[model samples]
Target: MYINLHNMQAIIALACGVLILIMPKLLNYIVALYLIILGVMGIVRF
Candidate 1:
């Protein structure tokens, strides 16, 4: 399956939201990692 950039980001955001809801303590790390990954992906165009 080939998912587009928007869809992939949405999925990741949703997953991170769920994880944050489940474990509030990880909210900071989850958001940070998500942003970092998005940045890297944008740079690499992957």
Candidate 2:
């Protein structure tokens, strides 16, 4: 499968944002992890 990791990460981030609205506790970890992962993906070009 030709899956795009960047797009996948974006989708995950979007989902996390929606989830965060329901559960504010996840805001820190989810957004932090998503940003870190997305940053790495962008820098490394994966």
On TM-score, the leading prediction is: 1
Q: lDDT per prediction?
A: 0.88, 0.82
Instruction: Give the per-residue lDDT digits (tens) of candidate 2, residues 2-26.
Output: 6586678667878997999999998
lDDT of 1 by residue, 1-46 (tens): 8898888888988998899889999998997898898799878975
**TM-score, per-candidate, Cα-based:** 0.79, 0.59
Looking at model 2, residue 18 earns an lDDT score of: 91
| Model 1 weakest 10-residue run by lDDT | 37-46
Off by over 4 Å in 2: 1-10
User: What local lDDT does model 2 show for residue 35?
Assistant: 79
Tell me the number of clashing residue pairs for each predicted model: 0, 0
Q: CA shift at 20, candidate 2, in angstroms?
A: 0.8
Residue 38 C-alpha lDDT in model 2? 70
